[model samples]
Target: MTKAANFIWYELMTPDPAGAASFYGAVVGWTIAAHNDAAVGGVDYRMIVRGDGGNAGGVLALGADMLAGGARPGWLGYLEVADVDAAIDAIKADGGAVQMPATDLPVGRIAMVSDPQGAHFYIMDPIPPEDAVPGEGGVFSVTEAQHVRWNELATSDPDAAIAFYKKHFGWGQEGEMDMGPLGAYRFLQRGDVMIGAVMPLMEGYPVPVWNFYLGVDDIDRARAAVTANGGTITSEPMEIPGGEYAMNAIDPQGAPIGFVGPRKS
Candidate 1:
């Protein structure tokens, strides 16, 4: 059987590439790299890196043509699957919609999918194998800077989202976490790995959306860097009851993202 999907890369589509690059560089200590052929639909792209010089993620220049077609500024998460065709079939069979059919890229094959509840994610089959043992550059590397540690899907129908993902991805339910009046948080596990999560959207929120969490060594420093770089901090830094410290923020173009520091036990 194929191993469960692993999240490998994330990219943000925003209106301002320079500003987004500057903001993220300060906040996450990323080194911004520009590519001559990074354009998709004719828009420029900027690559982000950790201070140690490893590629962390990417940002796209969302031009007017993109906005006119009804694209919103948001972060895109990529998960590694064993076979893109099989994943797309499972997704459609489970009632989810395919935003984009499987397309081949030099790096891998990719498909954009929306869950039954409307949260979007991309699945990929990297050119290189993804299930290689750790320390051998599997899907991601901790020594290169923190890889994606978690993905949270905020949706209107949490149960339906959970069912669809479980059917398509073979994720098992871990348990529910109480968020006071916000309702219950459902956690999922892939094999023995806890890759991401699903949660019901609170009242007054719009459609289902997914948020990506980038791991950091210091939460407070990350928060400070965000403010210093012209990004807005949507939430104040606070320790969750479980001991992790996190803060939500938006880049210069108003794309939602977050940073999390390890819990002190």
Candidate 2:
């Protein structure tokens, strides 16, 4: 089993790139730029980042081919894998589905996969000589900006999901936290690092889904900024059991996302 590195980038394939970029830029104070080139198969790509050129990410033009194939507008997280081919094989062996076979990128190899329970994520082998810079205005931040600090999988079978991931990614369980009416929260760890958690979706909630946590210094300010832009608040800022605060919001295109910070004691 190979040790997984931190999340490096996040990408979105949406039907309307311009609209999606505008919504995220206004909501998150990102500077959106368009990239058009004959390289990368001659596709039109767009980049989004904070004004400071930190916390950068990307969006792809959700063209007719993608739409015809049933790709919806949503956020996809990219995890650093030691070997892209091995990761894809492990994913398939663990009951996951490979949406896209491994493809080589300028940086490294990448593949999009859905876990056994239907949660989607990406695996990438970073271009060895061209490692991603932390906090470099990208979706997956490390040092300069807050990268994805946490990920949560809301699934019907938490134990099964845990077991599958443990076998596939060498992740270990870190006990469970009480979520009151929401039941217990199961934490997953890799090596000495806590990567994310797994939990049963609240009763009557939607099907299993993956949630990414974006770090922020001030929850209120972030929430306010979200609304001031074209985004809408789906949930008010609330403290979880362990003293962390979070809130949900929809990007201008109605794709949902979350923000978190230290809870006030």
Candidate 3:
């Protein structure tokens, strides 16, 4: 049985899909194409295409009903599991909750779930297409530009969050960085890869959530493109241990996003 280890896909839910497509096209260099779905009465869901023409994830236009349900424009990640329904059962057994029950799409079976601390993400059992490549990885890549580079989680309980994921998803705590008063920034590993880190949930985030960082060629140039395209920078570029720079920003409609790249002066 394969455990859920990687965040295989990412989706940004915004009220303005075309505008988001334009914004990311400038900032992250992703091209979007509308996915014609007969299921949701043809909802405006666009695919995020990377430079290598691989699927990064999607940009979904939030409907009025979704907005009324208090859905805001934010990015969410999807973990590929062997069985979506079984994954939900295990999540519940481990003190997690399912926001959406298991449902079958044209492509796969999926359910929305949260850890015990309430950080939400999806679990899916994908049905590969006839032309799909064997063992092909999804949206995330540690070194590829225009792909998700990191999966940072600001959880209410870092210790418990780390334990839960390790037991369920085969993740391990690899290292630690003491952030003085903000709490420990502990690294998370999936097999041999350092996928991301977990930190103490900060002051303003109402709930625990995953912040996926996309890769760019140059941090400074991407920063300028963000402001030029109507996004707001939340955190200024900060140099990390690897000598790369990372920063946080929000889309024009207020969806939080992150970027990682070289800081070229």
**Reference-based TM-score of each model:** 0.86, 0.83, 0.95
Best candidate, lDDT: 3
The TM-score that candidate 2 achieves is 0.83
Off by over 4 Å in 2: 36-39, 128-146, 203-206, 241-244, 262-265
Query: Weakest 10 consecutive residues, lDDT, candidate 2?
Result: 135-144
For 1-265, candidate 1 gives per-residue lDDT tens digits of 4465666778788887777777776766666665523433344766676766566767777788889998878898887777889888878887788998898866678899888887888888777546545312232432223455567889988888887767666778787889888888888787776666788896535888888777777788788788888888988776753577877888778888877785333
lDDT for each of the candidates?
Answer: 0.73, 0.71, 0.88
Q: Across residues 1-265, which tens digit of lDDT does each residue of candidate 3 receive?
A: 3454777789999998878888999999998875534543456777889988988888888989999998899999988788788889899999999998998887788899999999999987877779875334568888888999999999999999999998878788989999999989999988788999999999878899999999999999999999999999999999998899999999998899999999878
lDDT of 3 at 126: 78
Candidate 3's TM-score reads 0.95
Query: How many residue pairs clash (N, CA or C atoms closer than 3 angstroms) in each of the candidate models, in the order given?
Result: 0, 6, 0
Task: Report lDDT (Cα) of residue 116, candidate 3.
Answer: 99
Per-residue alpha-carbon lDDT of model 2 for 1-265, expressed as tens digits?
A: 5453555777766777777766665445565566543334556666666666654556777778877888777778777777788878778887888988898876568899988888888888766445546423245432222445567888988989988877766788888988888888998786676767899976534667778766666677777778877778888988865676878887766567877776433
> Model 2, residue 42: displacement in angstroms?
3.5
